[model samples]
Target: MGNETNEFDRVTMFGADWCRDCRRSKALLDSLGVDYEYVDVEADLSAADRAEAISGRKNIPVVVLPNGKHFVEPSDAELRGELEAAGVL
Candidate 1:
């Protein structure tokens, strides 16, 4: 992800490609037609640190909603609820 001021303004998901939960969430976002930023923690140490800082957990798939709320290792149903609540779904 870039260092743009608006980077986190939208729905941002910090995760690695190899993570099953990450892939599942990514697919959910895609299926819902929700726009989001995917930060590959495997590719950027700083992004990983940021994700940990946001969720206070060393877990993959830290999904930050546009409202500044975050979910760590959330299930598909949880993601769906959040997206719907955020009016993105």
Candidate 2:
């Protein structure tokens, strides 16, 4: 985990450990030294509902940004751009 600048500095990722994309996204975040809160949808069923509330779909690797924006199963490039835009990269 990285520094916590404020309440909104947290990056919330909703996905299960078995998900490949989730692992990839987490790796990217870790590589870039970004702190994130990983919500395992499988471990806690209620987390799936939270993911649906944010994404409007049942998609693994739903990444919720600090500003409440999200990317659903984004590519590496897409995730990179988001990290750059957030000043994390």
Candidate 3:
């Protein structure tokens, strides 16, 4: 997932292309028809640090909501809650 999203109330995903968890997050978002913006830390230093700062781990699939609330390695249920909260679902 790159900085290519389609919905408003941007959901920013900070991850690398090689990350499976990131891929899972991307697939989930796509299945929900909720467009989310993606930032590749592999290419952007800011994104890497941002994800690290929020998650406290170098874990992939760190998702930042429009309001700047973040989720680290969240489950599908958790992600659904975020989508609902953001009125995306």
Candidate 4:
């Protein structure tokens, strides 16, 4: 599932619907106007593996930021910080 926020321009979210962190991250990203496409780890095995390869963890809510970096279960504060740092917030 996806909800678009125009400010981010680009965002790739790696997660599962069942994950609370994923839910929180998505909510924050949306509230902050961060548009993103979602990749569900459970529903999409390939993405899950790829995310694991990069993060070395099976955790949900692994966000691929617009600048081409990854964040593993980052907190709301962290996401806000990143958005501010990227000048999107």
Judged by lDDT, which candidate is best?
1
**Model 4 TM-score?**
0.80
What digit string (tens of lDDT, one per residue) describes model 1 on residues 1-89? 21223336789999998999999999999998988989999899899999988888898899988777788888999889978987777
- If scored against the real structure, what TM-score would every candidate get? 0.89, 0.85, 0.78, 0.80
Off by over 4 Å in 4: 1-9
CA displacement after TM-score superposition, residue 70 of candidate 2 (Å): 0.3
RMSD of 3: 5.9
Q: For residues 15-34, could you state the per-residue lDDT of candidate 4 as single tens digits?
A: 88888999999999888787
lDDT of 2 by residue, 1-89 (tens): 22322334578888888899999988888887888888899889899997887777898898877865688898889988887887666
**TM-score for candidate 1, residues paired by index:** 0.89
Cα deviation of 71 in candidate 1 (Å)? 0.2
Output the number of the TM-score-best candidate: 1
Give candidate 1's total backbone clashes.
0
Cand. 3 TM to true fold: 0.78
Instruction: Name the runs in model 2 displaced over 4 angstroms.
Output: 1-9
Q: What is the C-alpha lDDT of each candidate?
A: 0.85, 0.80, 0.77, 0.75
RMSD, each candidate, Å?
Answer: 4.7, 5.3, 5.9, 6.4
